[model samples]
Target: MKHILRTSMLVILIIILAACANDEATSNEEGNKDEGADEELKIFTTVYPLQYFTKQIAGDQASVESILPPGSDPHTYEPTTKEMVEIAEADAFIYNGAGLEPYAKQISDSIKSEDIKILEAAKGIDLEAHVHNHEEEGNEEGAHEGHNHGDQDPHVWLDPISSVQLAEHIKETLVELNPEQEEAFTKNFEELKGELEILDQEFHSQLEDLPQNKFIVSHAAYGYWEQAYGIEQIAVSGLSPTNEPSQKELENIIEKAEKHNLNHVFFEQNVTPKVAEVVRKEIGAETLRLHNVAVLTEEDIKNEETYLSLMKHNLEQLTKALSNSKSGDSSESEEQSDSDHGHSHGGDEEAQKIYDGYFEDSQVKDRPLSDWEGDWQSVYPYHEDGTLDEVYTHNAEDSEDMTAEEYKEYYEKGYKTDVDRIVIDGATVTFYKDGEEKFGEYTSDGYEILAYEVGNRGVRYIFKLKEEKEGLPQYIQFSDHSIDPTDADHYHLYWGDDREALLDEVTHWPTYYPSDRSGDEIVHAMMQH
Candidate 1:
């Protein structure tokens, strides 16, 4: 009995000791808040991907936060006051600065904290404006940017070798901040480098001799990949989600599409690339997709899509685009002088205008007969639970009958189909979609959210602007980047405020969609919401 009692007492002591040890470790990891331990270093990152990277390197010795909110469009985004405060309080602020976030410089400039360690997450590569993500830039015509000119496409992190360089940067910073962890930091860095090395090898091996070099992407987001590899990104436009081309420029792109024997002209998942649809029909290209690692939606984040996943997805899209890519003949090698690429990435406004100008008008430059007179409106395909019950045009037009040959039967021909949006007669501001009647609910301009769906019926935006009023300026037109699914409906509809001009844009066909009618469906439905 004495022995049993002794064993029980020892066990209790051991348990207490373990608890104390754990508590001590937690304290050390978080920071030496207690009277006599080492304090943990603080770490802050611009986005979740960087947070993941820092967490891997810092382990429990650092705290991390992604400044951008979930689903927030990181590009063209300005941080809130609260975010600015948190940034000021951080010990280290890491951001990808190869022209990825044009606002990063702004945010950094705004903050007065010079003491905080800043880590520009790119390594090995330095870009000025936009690099050669040729395929991606050409696909959207204009999507996802406004940072640098054509020299610095700061997406080097997309490449594995550069990502390793980033890891090294993180390690060096951590060691500088906390010299106590020098040995640990060195070991971690080595291991991390090894992993990165393996990843880089995998990428090289997978992409080394792929039969194709060009592919369509949603934006001007993948220039680094092209520089690192042989891939050519054919984006719809140059850099800057804000750029839009004039009619002549649009025609040149279409001519290039045809001349290049291009198969696809892609767009992004979140924001609509309104400028793409014109080129899509002109060259009869296929619709492909590639994700830019700026800021992913909740679904992508939850699925844990890393830079690796995104790059792999890009490879898959490339596979499809290259199938029809024009071969680079012998002449391509002779003119390869050290040509200075003075490509100014002045493309965002122009790109947005592609959507705005065409969708805002009721004229088709290519086709003038098929006038889509139905009101184009935005509909909330997904409810609060994020479940989509509405039958999208892609799904709705999936029957085998709407083949290209038979499409002309009911097709209204060429009339620039424009989606018309008007704020309520007098109120704060509201917008509607598909020409919904404007009244009670859609009377506030505060809820303008861009939404899209993809399938055979081409890509579409279900715009919602109910709270808008007369005092508010017209919201931007953004339905031009329609996805062109081979098997989708050909009865393209355009509902806009103008009629004759809209028809003019569509009569030119590939540059615009044909529409036959316009209505109050979109505005009325949006107002009811």
Candidate 2:
């Protein structure tokens, strides 16, 4: 009886110990689950747009923070030690390239970990060449020979299309960092691109029919606009506000304002308008404000002003100033004119050519796929992973149609490569690399490639139908997006209904390599072709 009681007590104690161990294990698992839910990718940015863009694309999947405080100028702002520490701890650092942030390169180099990725948000963008005036230099032309004096316009985010590219690049980086959230990032990016398209249309509609084409701006930040639209930006200051205009330069501006009958002297809201006020007073013009968006004000933050809203504001001001000037009264003109206000470069055919290379029109939707059907082929490369890194090896002597220099260079590089051909059968696009159907029956989303190959090299081709118009021969325009000029040559193919004509037309197809041309140059070439 005593032995039986003792064994019973021992069994009871063992059950209690087991129960306690299970409870502890359950508590630890719950803790781990909570930690996993809270984990997020940390991203650090140099400017407000980069932060805004990352947040929009990353959504709740990542934490996007800006190093530049609200209302701080990106050009002149310096990061504190706290911000540097944050960068060190971040998973990635994204900054606007083209020399906008002086400290970004240094901070990136100082980071010891190879795990942290540093991305140039503006990478692959074709920056505009801006002319900078040196305070010590007298002659404008010869003072800077073969040198632009750090005058590449870094404010590419101002343009809607360029902003789209920047957003895509950001999404690509984020996807690479945390591929688990690629679907989320891609969906968000598409929505953002749609918004940008709408913004682009608004600009086109508002400014397309304006009477005056030129506007005097506070600074030379609108070169992208000048390139996109025909609207010329005459800056009172150079690229940076630091390049204050001399008395003679101000006098020239006043004279031009009078000649063009500009009724408003434009000033940046972020910058003090003292100099612009002087120009306005001398020219007797009213003061109008523009936002550079390099920095935001306290009010801008409260109002939730984004890149789109600020750009729209700019459009409103531009439309009012340019349109109102055309029908202004003599007194109104006089109020805006300087003492010697007769110097005007009136709208001539030569002046009109400035608007020639705009590609916004070419980006319009294609004819519905049901309307026609045919096979279209082009020399395009692809990979299993869809990376362009293999182009150096894969772009060798592949086809008879390959350019001489391209073939010889890669051939001597000892890379025996086969040319990949892209064949469009009806709405289905097939990518053939080295005689294998790497990607087949890929349906397109209208004219845009819904899913395509990319890595390292930057370029995209759009097949457009000219709609059987007289004198406007139907052709497919290959839009190249490669930021590097030396990567590969993109071409445009002109062919009618005859499928056999595609082969013969290939000989006449214009070859555009990145190294041989600028974005504007390529656009002009396509237009001229």
Candidate 3:
């Protein structure tokens, strides 16, 4: 009996010791988990770009999550209660703010913890001016549908420089949240900045010398690019893909496509391309996709398309669009330039009388056949208060010796002789040393205008309008600089509200050409004009 009691006690003691040991181990594990949680910063972003910047900047130092699902449209996305809960619990919530994610402010407000950091990724970047007026009184479940946020275009991340700014914002926030990781975040941000600079350089080099500079896009997201690169984008839809264009708008787009001689209609991965296809078919144009980078498609995720790769792809497509572009109806005219070289506002009665006489007179069927009929003198494409956006001159002397075919060949062979000074003021274009003066007049077709000498047979030159609008100065010619895509000025002249004419002026286009010139200089130049 004594031996049995002793053995039983020994077994009980051993079991108790094992239980204590197990409990202690469990406590240690829990403590370690808590410590690890404290070390990791939980980051939440509203869109792919912000999430991408956060990840690239934070690396392994933080755990980042995008509240928006892949392929979700940022314009229409609304956070669920669960998502709000997640934001409330996160260490930091980062979003592209210039009004892109409408839910961002609301969810951020709902967070109970003051400890959670709410960072706007686009904090330091300048946002484009976009006004979306929401008129539906009943649909105010906080939707951007018809609402306009004045002077705020939330798509800054589309530009690489803006992207760099966004990354810096994220890095600054992360470093603030965890100072211990400051060095790591700074290093990562610097690397990202370098990469973005390289991307910007690539854009400069590749897009600098294309034959055409205008493109049509599904959405007006590329405003930043338009300002930065001097390319014009006519969007099929409004800033939000959800803002479907009316039938008249569709017709207008088709008309512009015809007017611009556009060969491609660009679509986005997130939006349905049905409307884009209709425009494409009507215009006999091909369809192409441009990744907005606001969200990722499943294919993009599966293919692991990084922001850099997607931007590179966009650059390639843009280049292709411009290079393959036909100059509206100027193909024949350009053939002549190789053979021969030749080159809105609703105000000013001289312009109005001319527009009505040449464009609106029903009796003059051939005379008023096109909307661009009127006398257009050359005004600098940008407001005069600044230096000329760009200037290039082509000498006819070089091609004088070549046969029409050989003249064409010379241009095809990329041989160019610079003009001493080329000036176009309103109706006259003069090449000083080249000894050529073109008197421009309107034609039935908007693209091809008539350029003549005192008594010589006229040559046809292609022209474009800033936008499809009715007015006298509606037509502007492409400068010789149009041949070089890199030139800050592609199209020449602005006709319309004097304010609109100042588009390239610093006062109007603060980001245009990304220059260091002050707004005062630009305004001064405009005053001179």
TM-scores vs. true structure, each candidate: 0.51, 0.54, 0.54
> In model 1, which regions exceed 4 Å deviation?
1-40, 109-115, 128-150, 324-529
lDDT tens string, model 1, 1-529? 4433443454445445545555666757545445433556677677556776677778778887778776666655666544555565567888877656655655555443455788777745455346433333343344433533445666666666777777788888888778888888888778767876776666566677655666555466666677676776666656655565556666766776666676667676465567777777666665555666666666565445665556555555554456445433221111110001000111246433332322332222221111121112222221112222121222225545454333332222322223233221111123343655333221111111222221111122222234444432232222233222111112223333443333333222221111221222322221221
Off by over 4 Å in 2: 1-38, 131-149, 326-529
Lowest summed lDDT across 10 adjacent residues in model 2 is found at 334-343
Q: Please give, for residues 1-529, the per-residue lDDT of candidate 2 as tens digits.
A: 4433443444444345535554676778766976765588899988777888889999998888888887776766667655666676678999998878766766676563555788898878887876443221342432121122275788888888898999999999999888888999999999999998898888888888787888877767788887787788878776666566777777787778788887676778667546677877776665566787777777576545787777777776777667756333222111110101111112334322211211233333343221212222232222122222233223333345555455334323221223234433223333344566522222222333221122111122334343343422233433222111111223333333433343233223322222323333433332221
What is the lDDT for 297 in model 1? 69
Tell me how candidate 2 scores on lDDT. 0.57
Which ranges of candidate 3 are over 4 A from the true structure? 1-38, 131-149, 327-529
Give the top-scoring candidate (lDDT). Answer: 2
The per-residue C-alpha lDDT of model 1 at residue 354 equals 33
Q: What is the lDDT of candidate 3?
A: 0.56
Q: Which of candidates 1 and 2 reaches a greater lDDT?
A: 2
Per-candidate local distance difference test: 0.48, 0.57, 0.56
**What's model 2's lDDT at 268?**
80
